[model samples]
Target chain A: MPVDHKRINGPENTIPYKLYTKLNVKSFKEALQDAVKNGVRNDKRKLDEHRRIFMKTDIVSQAKGSAYIEIGNTKVVVSVFDPREIPNKNEYSLNGELYCEFKFAPFSCPKRRLHQQDAEEKQNSIVMKQALEPAVCRHEFPNFQVDVYALVLENDGSALSAAITCAGLALAQAGIPMFDIITSVTIGIQGDLKLLDPMLHEETLCYTSINKNSKTGKNSHGIVILSLLNTHQQVTEFYQVGSLDIDDIEECTKVLTEANKVVVPLVEKCLAKHVIKGVKESSQ
Target chain B: MTLSEAEKTFILHGVQENFRIDGRNRDDYRPMELETSIITHAFGSARLRLANTDVVVTVKVEIDVPFPDRPLEGKMEFFIDCSANATPDFEGRGGENLATEISNTLTAAYSSNSVFDYTKLCILKGRKCWKIYVDILILECGGNLYDAISIAVKAALWNTSIPLVKSVTIDGNNVDMNVSENLSDCIKLDISAAPLMVTLCKIGDHCVVDPTSAEEQCSQGAIVVAISKGKFSTVFQTGGGSLHPLTLMEKLKLGAKVGNRLEEALSEALSKIKENGEMGFLN
Candidate 1:
């Protein structure tokens, strides 16, 4: 839906959807079982399996630094160009030049469409930008914007998560120094059944449940989108379940671990392919 | 928009020779990138990019009393917001006028019955109907805003899901909508007739579909055609320059062909969208 401030009729729609999302899943346990069965094969490997990631540096001809990553059907092309000179003189961040845009072609989705960034996409872009900040060596680059434009032509799921991993890979690929990889995962809870890497269908079922009873209500399956740092895999950025309880948090943690099982390796594989071999991290 | 001599000359030269810097023929559109179901939060969402010009569209539905005049037909509205990142020119409210113009154009393009069936959104006669809000957020402007916005809006709509109201309680004036508890208890809008806008920009003696920002500045005039289900839903003119009747017809044919290709490609892409969680910036 196109968000128009002037039109009062539609904003209600956006707000209500976010709030009272009804559940499509029959039960949380059923959804979880379905996800596990559908996402991974009998052998335990993911069905639409993303391969081991590999990253390399200086791939962008015109960019100062760049990286390329492929995770199954998910592929990201990022270019860390010169720190964009922010023209607004009065405004400056001690963190240095920084800008990130996440984009997907209509061709990227199963259904094609025109190009327009909406609220969810915008939020995701900002989330990705934030997730990349600590992970990239922005101090070394300074005063210059690192343009990390992620293009997903094919989607298996977990886009922002992939983008975070991909951006880190790109930073390393560009030979831009970095601290750690910012890996992300999307975990969902139906009832007692918690799952990871919820795809479009699963998401639909998921939201139906979450939207219906947001609180400790019976059919609530809130989203648990989290960003993690690679050193021992700790949480850095989090937008976990909203208004849920401690028990729910525990359920989400289990799902998060399950997500990492699929995502962590993909990040490493991409890093291996794109990052330069001999550029040692400074230890001053 | 003001044009610089060097930029203008560069575009004019490319148009004169029937070639764009991106290597697209004057009549050829830039490679379009489209994704559907990208935004999990929204019931239906799609992102379309015509080269650097990008638009993200999300469709949200809600129950509301119908307009006094159009009670049977549900409401459909368009909202366009131009991001400052696209260009400094769009900073603050600078792009409001343009945004309004494009949104109005879109509304008009999709208003006709042939383009979109508004009655399908009606739940109760004059009581409640699905008010679909097409939120268009322009991230970048490479040119051809009309076509990009229109296509993205349509895609987002096609991806929209109106909650199947199992029942409704008429509590005097305060009515209550009983939403279906069944997860698959839903209805999908058949948007095959939804129109896709194709822009024809005139250059020298010929017209081109999907012009870049530079060429848009150089164009004397342009036309926007909204085609639905292989038929021309609506055709209107844009830009400062006007067009001859004969030339407009010729361009209309070209626009229709392009629209067909776009619709086919879009349908195929949309059909391929899996329930898998493969979305976001990193594909």
Candidate 2:
């Protein structure tokens, strides 16, 4: 058996199938204009509207705790494993550790992704860990490590924020002690237009500087993702990209803080529903 | 690397009093030494030393095809390597997390077209372009790695020179181009809007810039703000602590203020630096 069998063979370079579609014939500028017209997006959502969210817990039977969430076309599943002894450590630790892994399924995006984690996924894992660390009471399980794995089944946009929210729910479902429920939101900025919970197309438009304003040199374009602990009113994680003015950042923060509130009630309701179901089954 | 309770208390008290172990104020940065063109083999190179932290950055370029979507723009990447010489824990894959974080921050900061124009590197639309690889090596880690790395990367980019393309001809599916043979006939990168990162470590109720390792341990949370020109390119919160929204905004303000001053100082230093004939590791 002299064949190279370590990995499956594939095309040297594969372009996304979406690129060959006839619907993508228009120029990007015209497409961007069509994405949002007359204060309404192509999806008919308002400028500050968020995509409908569906969340559920206890999806993975093998895992200690698991959650699945869907924000429009983007779907993510997060599983949390029980705390185990920390690996390769001899001394005691004052606080427990969290191991986060964020992965995108091969068929999740428009283009096929590799099995191995890419740089973007690795960075998302770190952000996920940081976002959840403050809410978890790590001192209770010192010298132990809890593993949280997030898999993006479909990535339309705001996948990281969805994963963070799902991970928080999974941690809570796993009986992990926490200070408060965490909710995250993403906002896309393009010039003066601010879209809340943007889809993939709007996100791309905001990312690119196609319509840059050169006069002021203050290009208000980028993405701002904020994770908030509602109870304490503390921000667990804040990640931003692109170039923006100070006032724009402040406004974005304010808008994101408010936007985060929209998802808190939904998360709380889901957890409460799960708890009641468990109680009913036990009573029976 | 572990500090005792007494040592922690001492540092906390010093922070509360607006004084630090190194006798610096809340916003005071440690003295820095910067040298450019240290790597003769690299197209451009720079080494920056801020007190105990040290970093080296080099820029390399190669001819490559541009992305289909953005054919007018070239490509740029940031790769950070944390050497074991910086610390024993960085051996093998231990430093990968930190390396990825720093590199990702740099990528986000430079993603904006206004920050660094990529179209200038394109030799032929959608066919040929120059792909720049900025490699950074962390020789030591005292604290404030982001700030130090950003400064070195800016300096290296400033020192970089791209070879000019003489001409290009496309026939059917094949393309041919002639590059300038003259060594001095090259175009320099425009680094005027290059972003520089400033880490604001929140200690007690005050935020400090350029914190030492000891000071980093005593902080609650920190924010890294990358400023380009007068606007902010990226703002990231790191560490395992949470911050109030008010405190976060205040830290951002402080970071911007300090970043402007840093940008000014860096420009001043860069202007004063002349291409010295004798410059290398031996110096």
Q: Each candidate's chain A: what TM-score?
A: 0.69, 0.94
| RMSD (Å) per prediction | 22.5, 2.5
Instruction: Find the 10 residues in a row with the least total lDDT in model 1 chain A.
Output: A10-19
Best by lDDT: 2
lDDT of 1 by residue, B132-207 (tens): 8888899999999888887788778877777889887888887788898786667888788787888888887888
- Note the Cα lDDT for every prediction shown: 0.65, 0.90
Give the local distance difference test score of model 1.
0.65
Candidate 2 C-alpha error for residue B89, in Å: 1.7
Clashing residue pairs for model 2: none
| lDDT digits (tens) for residues A1-284 of candidate 2 | 12355777487467776666886677757877899998999889998999999999999999999999999999999999999999877678899989999999999988788777778888899889999999999998999999999999999999999999999999999998888999999999888889999998889878866666467533578999999998799999999998888888899899999999999999999999999999999999
Chain B of candidate 1 versus the native chain B: what TM-score? 0.92
